[model samples]
Target: MNTQSLTKKWSKTICLAFLYSLSIFSNCYSKGNRIQSSDLKDSLISLLKKSGNDTLMIDSVYAHIRINRRRLGEEYKNTLLEYIDYTTKIQYSRGAMRMYDRLGLNERYDERYDSAVYYHLKSLELALELKDSFQMAYNYNNIGQAYRLQDINNLAIKNFHKALELQEANGNDKGASFTQNTLGAVYVVQKEYDQAMHYFRESQKIAVRRKDQRTQSYNLGAIGEVFLLRDQPDSAIVYFNTAKDIKQQMGDKKGLAVSKHLVGQAYFKKGNYVEAQKFLNEALVIHQKYNNERYIALCFDYLGKVKLKQNQFSEAGAYLLKAKEIASNIHSYENLISINNSLKEYYQEMDKWPMAMLAIQQNQQINDSLFSLKKTREMQALEIEYETEKQEQQIKLLSAENEIKEQRLKIGIAIITLLVLTIAFGIFIQKEKQKRFVLERDKVKQQLLRSQMNPHFLFNALGSIQSYMYQNDVKTAARYMGNFASLTRSILNNSAVEQVSLEEEISTLTNYLELEKMRLQSNFQYSIKVPEEMDIEFITVPPMLIQPFVENAIKHGIKNYTSGGKVELTFEETSDLIHVIIEDNGEGIDTTRGKMVSSHKSMATSIFKQRMKIIRDKFPNVPEPVIADLSDVNRKGTRIDLYLPILELTSTSNA
Candidate 1:
């Protein structure tokens, strides 16, 4: 497949892209409707099965392949790129090209239009070199698919025509038919309904002409898709049924699954929950059977809708979750957006405004990103064409003289690959940041949660006090009720501050400990190693973050200790952090299994750990509280070290 020329040409293109970062179209085509076939099915399957020796390579391949091929069949599409990477490194051009093509499809599925176009163009280059016109046409068709996904109809129409021409020229009837179908989609996107229907009819004719059941199924599905777009659910159902019959006859589970999904959607649109659920369930089984994850995700979403209508709240929630995972993993942006919106709706139904808002944000983010990408693709086109004007022209002249070298397309394809790779990298970083931000926000909520105490627990405490009062034990009941009132006051005070002043926080802890002391008189003693003149107020920490550890010390360690039951609290403030030390001379923790805690013995200790986890996740730089057994082997004692970064503030009042 001219490995040397391919590498050289690809490298040349990359070098130009790094400096320019633009995109160019080597050729254009008019839109056409074509039927789908199983031409690339074997190639997809073969690539999916390739597990390179390197696990990372396997992962990369799986990710890329999973991106594209997982929709067609139950095969792992994500792993395709990894295999292609290994194959390319090992100089397996055939496998590399297949992987490259798969990568483009992955990007296309991801709604990364520029990237998909770039990669597919490269695939086209390799296919043309290999003299595999069918493969080249496949690439063109995929590129058109990418554009179609982006709603770039002019370009989609153009690339679809290129594929159609190549397929027809090479007598690749199936390729031609499918390419024609895609063109119809572009027309639909452009709202040229007549042209769209014309292409669909043309695609159907080709499918029947070729007597290919697979193509016929896809043609029917394509018609259904258009009908669904027109909100003609009844008409869509008829076409979907036709597709289903053809797919079932051919034993093409994936095709049958999508058909059923369409039928489900049709029923869903007609407000027929029972029929929708039935068809959607059938679709789900078929999708899972064929490993058609994309369709499976779709079915999950529709199932959730059905469950929601049936008032099966838990079932609806479960299905939505599965839908989110599949849609996100598959890079089905539209599907992801839909799934997220559905999740938002579910949360809204539950009256969870915060969760609903969060889900809505996620859904909006996908839409925002797609919109941004569409804008970037436009800018990139101008940049690529302008920067590579000279080299591109030179390649054009050469291609005109000898059609044997479609180097321009190769170069554009290389550029597309680079663009997709870069965008993937950026998205990864953005996603991580988003995760961190969400974690931080939740930590803030956790820090504030105590203000809203559980009424039942409050009831129990008050009831205990009331029993004492009813028995004329006024002193004991008064002491217990006073402690409860103090705890409530601290909760209120803590709720008002985003972060706690070290001095005020320590005072709050002292109040809580004193109350516990009243409950278990003389069982424990505690002291804070705070300097009399130290400005503890200047050091801000997560509210109650340190208090939990101290509480754990009392409930587990000091309470059990027969002697030397003392809890020591110390604070050390430095330039960057405020370190808090909570050590008790009673009941050391079990060091086995990494400083294990018995939540059964002390729920306070367990809650402390959970709260700390939330803090660490929010403030990544804030270290986890370190636990150690500083006491002797048989001694009842444990020490915990917590390091909270100091808020960069000057005055205590400002905090």
Candidate 2:
């Protein structure tokens, strides 16, 4: 049988068997008195074994877990994980696929999109191996959901369309309905409201026909949002009320809260502050109960607006302040913008011109940040497209080569010498191509290293200069700006070079440290020492290799110290290698502060390690870099020793 036919056959068989098994399991559970979770788990395991490890019996158990997943609390994820382990042990691909899909759903609920996508892709691979169209569509839909959360709209739409196509081909109305709803959401985010409503209506029709109340409710709310965006508050409220009624009937507190919030927004836009406040307060209570920070902030923002309209300035200020705090803490840039705008309005109403000006300035800064972020996403999208095109071209080249090989085979001995020549030329071309590829790859890696130099450093350095300028200390500001300019120039120049003279590297480090010290208001002192015997001009080291460690030392270690912070760098040359030792006199790497340092520190460390590995691989005589925490030896700081092979001019030419 064909794959599609086989999928259909198995799906039908599994559905029937699953239903029968579910009925038996439900009946047994219903007949019993209250049973502990341990007893229930043991009974399920016994039944699983008794059924000869049947996949259908496993599905029934998964179904029960999923149905009561919310009630299972924090243990629900663990239960699914255990089921996955059991299914894998039995070599049950279908059960494992389902369990993986469930785990992805759990991750998605937790807002962990990367983990969700990983699990969904795992499920997709297994589904493909099994040729199971149902599971394939399910996983595709889920992967799309994860991508959508990450705002990767193009990939999300592609996966959603794939799932929709599969669902339609398989006559799975339920799956198609869900995919339609998802596509509508993507369009809504893109601000294509008409297209969004079209898909939402399609989904609503199918969901209503299928008696899928949950999906129908979601569609109603989504359509209401489109109306709200169109400024038709009355129409929006009508749909919102319908969604709210459905959610209430289904006892979906979260959905009900969202609908209530939307209804409040509609009323607020219509200038009905009393009704808006009532609905918003109701939504706030539910959101708080659910611990939904984003929604809680939204509630506070709307409440603030309501109070402002009521002329309750004190209450308005308090609500707006709370919302701003939450939005800033969560790094919700869009929400922060909204809160700033509200603050601007609040201050304007109170005739606080300075406060209003500050609010406007902050809002402008946030807008710039949002614009930068959007451009970054667009650039990433372009990179993805470029990679896809590159792969397509590669495939085309391979296909042409295969065709040429076939033609050569047809000619036989008549073209044997020509074939040999062609093969030799091909090998030469391949070798040159690989050389160019490696050069380009290395160039890109170097550029990435330059780009990773923290942009925040530049911003703060400029801010320090600006502060000095504001204080009318032109001399101080000029000195700071000169240092900043020199450091940036040195970095840009070094980024293009494979290695730099030790003297030049030391000069760059001195300039960088001077600027940082000024930025930190002399909170830390730094010293660089070079051995008298070492030839600083002759010896060469990798550009920017040691700077990141010093930067980390200053930022994570010394900066955290209240006073008397110090960072020292010493360079020593051995017979075969140069050792650059960086030591910091500050509180050691505390486990409590590890999380804060892990992000940027880990990235820089990982990049440095990878670069060192590449160098060691190229020159096997080089030793690996070593890093040590002196706290392990009853000391109180971090010490990193970088082992770099010294490159002379002739050695560089040889390389």
lDDT of 2 at 453: 51
Question: Which lDDT tens digits does candidate 1 get at residues 1-655?
Answer: 5756654554444334322211111101112211122322343334335434434323323332322342334333434544665666765566667667777766765667677767776666666556565566677677666656655566667667866777666565556666777677677767787788887888888768756555567668878878888889999999999889977765556667778878989999989999999988987887787788888888899899888888898999999999999888889988888888788889988998999999888877878998898788777655644543453354332222134245446768999998997787986677576334221000101122352345644676666665665565655665565456445533532343456556556656666666555555457667777754344634566666676676668777777665457888888754346778888887576666565454443444566667667766655556666788866556557888888755433220100
1-655 in candidate 2: lDDT tens per residue? 8766754554454344444434533443353323345544554555455545765446645644644454456667777777887888889888888789879988988998778877877787677666667677777788777777777788778778877877776666766887888899899888999888998999998878866677789899999999999999999999999999988866678989999999999999999999999999999999999999998998899899999999999999999999999988898888888888888899999999899999889989988987887788777666754654474354332222343355456668668877787787986677576334221000101111354456687679767877876675656676675455435433432343466667666766776777777788878777788866455755667767777888888887776766578899999876446788999976666544422243355566777778877777655557655556678899888787777876534210000
Against the true structure, candidate 2 reaches a TM-score of: 0.47
* 58: Cα error in model 1, Å: 31
In angstroms, how far off is 119's CA in candidate 2?
4.1
Collision pairs in model 2: none
Deviation in Å, model 2, residue 165 alpha carbon: 1.7
- Among the numbered candidates, top TM-score falls to 2
Whole-model lDDT, model 2: 0.72
What do the candidate models score in CA lDDT, each in turn?
Answer: 0.63, 0.72
